[model samples]
Target: MVIPIHDKNPVSRAPVVTYGLIIANVVVFLLGPIAFAGPDPDAGRKARENAYLYHYGAIPSQLLGGAHGGHGAPVWPAFTAIFVHAGWIHLLGNMLFLYIFGNNVEDQFGRVHYLLFYIVGGALSTYAFAWANPTANAPLVGASGAIAAVLGAYAFLFPQARVTLLLPFLWFLPLRVPAWLVLGFWFVMQLPEFQQTIGVSSSSDVAYYAHVSGFVLGLVYAALVIGRGRGPDDPLRLRQKAESEGSGTPPLAPDYRSADPDDPYGQYHR
Candidate 1:
């Protein structure tokens, strides 16, 4: 399994929005049901947990023009669900990804645009899942869909950047892989599950289509924002230049080399 630990890419600006999002997610998860589950806490927490899921988590049926099913605050759940996670593992995993890839994406589009992109991507993902499973009753929660969007944007923007992956079977050996290879593979991997989940009329715990849809939205957003854009950092133009240099033949993807004097890691061309 390819587990991303970090990226070699550095940001030109401090990612305030990314940091805020991580903190917000942590705070919400701590306050949410996942953190309080002891026997003493369980009795009262169960009701709160149910309430949290119903009130904040996006129920597919409700989003797709179905009854509220007693879940209050149905309209706001689309945005709130982005911060709600089921467990510590879920919260931490999503936060880690956001932490890893968000900074650069935030740097790419400034703070405000990045924040807008994140929120919109999340809402779109939730809606996509809702469309896919209109009759299901499960309430989908977590930041995976949003984070997947970040991953998608990162994949297109820095396709050549090296992502450090922890390979556990090899004694937790660290392997640096290309972002395109990892993220592209990840997007492809989601297709089978997305296809399977598209027509089924059952309550699935995970909204795989949401993740897929969010990633696609991110890709489209990035393409529109970065394509034909005249900048060395723009991936689409760079790819086009590379292709042109190859006389229409596909050339080997080049690694993104850092040129910033402040970049402590210097330039990595592989």
Candidate 2:
């Protein structure tokens, strides 16, 4: 019920890569059987959908030792599957998350580094799922794995930022909360999914392994590589330290008083 709708964080640069990714997924979906019926006169809607998924989606069985039931090398699907989705709900959910969190992370890392991080994180996530469910025949699709990376990066870089959430029961009212609280809760909720049998894919409908692995990879990479081990942003603080030897009063903090318009703390700064 704690659905995130938006973040109070703002970015300095345009997120071309994020926008491009969304567009690409939309285009692919529109071209697929889900939106436009395929050219196969003999195939039914379900058959065409299955054919598309089998060809583009990543199958853990193929990724492991099983014979390739898909076209081309198995590696191709590992990457291509990032754009594929099982249904309209799947596509929209992933795209919504990416649009919400990707801007700030893209700005923090710059387009190039962020792009590489997203792609690699997604690819690795697929492999992580495949490793855990080596014998499972389900073909993994959708951009959840990549979007999870963006969520991790956003949580790291803007922990103090406020996220607006809309509860399904209270659809008319929006609640604003800290980024850390929201993202931390999200990561924690995924932990229990690990208890599902590792090699048994039928235990869960969602790819929890990929979701967790992608999140960890994004967070670790952001900390160690991109952010250089930097910790989360501290909240705005109030202090009465001596300003100068000559100045009698501790001089009211300039930044603390006059907040930047984009500051997440509203009227304060650290």
Candidate 3:
């Protein structure tokens, strides 16, 4: 599969924080088995490791209660699992997508709103997973669910934006594709997995349902919380619209005018 690297139309706000998140995920992954390994080394080791994930990861039984291995008590996994990844590749891959797409979404919602939206999307994703595979005891880890939400929001808000991806065929080559096409195809591809496994037990390890559900949740949440033409970090929507209506000219330059142009050496100016 091709790996995404960057996007054409990135958020105009602080992107440093987005990069910081990528760094954090990388560092955490490098810390190795100590942080993610299960409580027991043996005794259904894979299941136990995943159980720690289920206990700390998103589990539907914990959300809905008393149906199919549903945990009728409080679900703590929702919060912790957002930061916990299954492995280095898993962490790196998820963080890379987040690094590319999260800044714009965060800018749209502001840091606090974006963070809350991420957590909520993760919770919803867990709920969907638990609902889909109520009896499975496998551990679910990683930020894929939350990242899927970010992708959904990105796809909706910046459909025209382009993403730079590394396509590996004979060798690694970079290609730029529109965000709408990439994310839209991804969202569509997830649907069949959901349909095929609707009421059946998930024999496969991957929680495809959670990814699909989280993406939909992100789109819906973005539509509701971040309504049309109201991205906090994107003030160009109106200008773009005006340009389109008036002369079909390209949108005006982003408003980067300093509040006081005279302060040439101020940190803001710098």
lDDT (CA) per prediction:
0.78, 0.74, 0.67
Q: How does candidate 1 score on lDDT? A: 0.78
Lowest summed-lDDT stretch of 10 residues in model 2? 234-243
* Model 1 lDDT at residue 180: 92
For model 3, give the 10-residue run with minimal summed lDDT: 251-260
> C-alpha displacement of 53 in model 3, angstroms?
3.3
- What overall lDDT, based on C-alpha atoms, would model 3 receive against the true structure? 0.67
Question: Candidate 2: misplaced stretches above 4 Å?
Answer: 36-43, 193-203, 229-270
Residue by residue across 1-270, what tens digits does model 2's lDDT show? Answer: 367777765455578999999999999998888765534444578887888988898998898774667556668778899989877777888888888788878877889988888888898999999999998897898888888887887777667677777777885477777888888877766665444434323336689789888888888787777665333331112222232344433233232222345753443111
Model 3, span 5-101: residue lDDT tens: 7665534478655666677667755554535555545555565555555555555554556433333344666666667777656777788788778
Query: What range of 10 consecutive residues in model 1 has the weakest lDDT sum?
Result: 249-258
Best by lDDT: 1
TM-score of each: 0.80, 0.78, 0.74
